[model samples]
Target: MSTADTTDNAVRELLLVMPRLVGRVKRLPLPEQLRSLDLAPRHLSMLSLLLLDGPLTVSQLAGMLGVAPTTVSLIVSDLSRKGVLVRREDDADRRRRIIDISPDSRPAIAQWLSPGARAWRHALAPLSPAQQRIFVDTLLRYEAAVSTPTRTAPRRG
Candidate 1:
């Protein structure tokens, strides 16, 4: 096959395998500390964001998660009810509420995501520094591509 054809085939294989790999990762049982929380990936994702970015407003989270403010509010409510999240008035704008992952949750959240982290580390351990850098670079580029919103053509009449 031509180089272009070979590259296309490689891309097709990656596209097919990525989701299955993620599904397998997602199927791993939650650590006991996080089990009772009944968290979904979306929940974990928001909490993870908070853990990474500190407190954020509902609108800010909605923007990050690509959902509506009301949707994020519902998510915040559920996490709050479970004691995994805390909502506080923004110091500069009392009218705005900022949602933060409870400090108490940091340990559990870290433990919950640890399995995947370990798996990735194990998989990368044998790679040379150059290979590791290329792998990370590719992933960063892929993330950027997926995060960018594409303009869609209007439906035909």
Candidate 2:
């Protein structure tokens, strides 16, 4: 077999695997502890975004989530009810409230995320130390690329 054919086959394999990886990421139970809390999907999304991006204004959240500002407000209200989010008045603009993650939820986030971390550790454990490092590094890069805001195109529906 020609070298170019091998390269093409490898690329095809990666294309096939990409969707499976994405499906798994979307299914992660990052807030399992609060699942019985019966929080809305939008509320949990707001908390996860804050955990990733730090505190942000409602406008920023709207932009990141590709939803209207009012939609973000509704989500924030739910999160507050769930005790996962808090409202902070912006000092520079007292009329504008900045949403922030609740301090109590931080520990919960860490604890809930530990399982995924351990899973990755186990998955990569069989590789040699150098190979494991490279594999882990590649996964980090893939995560950053996948999670970047620009990667989420607006839904047509």
Candidate 3:
């Protein structure tokens, strides 16, 4: 195969792998929520994504959540009314609006998605310092590879 063909195959592989990986990882939280909690998995997730990716528009949130923009807008509006996310209009553009996470909501996000934060804390108690370092390095390498951009048609900046 030509170099372009090889790159295309690799890109296809990544596209195939991404949804599986995301599906596996994304389901972890929904079932873990306690019976009495007010926040559904989707609400926690929207908050978590906002925390991780920074503030975003409804369209952007829809892309990340794999939902329609109308769905995202409803969720954002609900969160905004509840004061978990604060809505603000762009001063420069006036037309663009954004939803920012409220300061009071930070603790809720930590409770929801603390990264591998809990597991790492537990591992630290049992593993030697060197073993901990090795595990962390391996995890970081996996993260870097997954985060790298995949082959795609070129876009003009």
State the lDDT of candidate 2 residue by residue for 1-157, as single tens digits. 9999998998799889989986886677756666676665566566667776788999999998889999999888877887878899999999889888789877787566555567767888889999988987987896798798775678897
lDDT of each: 0.87, 0.79, 0.74
**Residue 143, candidate 2: alpha-carbon lDDT:** 73
lDDT of 2: 0.79
lDDT at position 88, candidate 3: 81
Per-residue error for 48 in candidate 3, Å, reads 1.5
When 1 and 2 are scored with TM-score, the better candidate is 1
What does candidate 2 score on TM? Answer: 0.56
Query: Which of candidates 1 and 3 is the stronger one according to lDDT?
Result: 1
Q: Rank by TM-score, descending?
A: 1, 2, 3
Tens-place lDDT digits, model 3, residues 1-157:
8999998998799789868877865665533323244566688668777877888877778888889988888888877777678878867667877777888776656665775446547758798989889877976786788799889889899
lDDT of 1 by residue, 73-131 (tens): 99999989888889999999999999987888777777777676678789899999999
Q: Pairing residues by index, what is the TM-score of model 3?
A: 0.49
When sorted by lDDT, best at the front, the candidate numbers are 1, 2, 3
| TM-scores of the candidates in the order shown | 0.67, 0.56, 0.49
RMSD score of candidate 3 (Å): 11.6
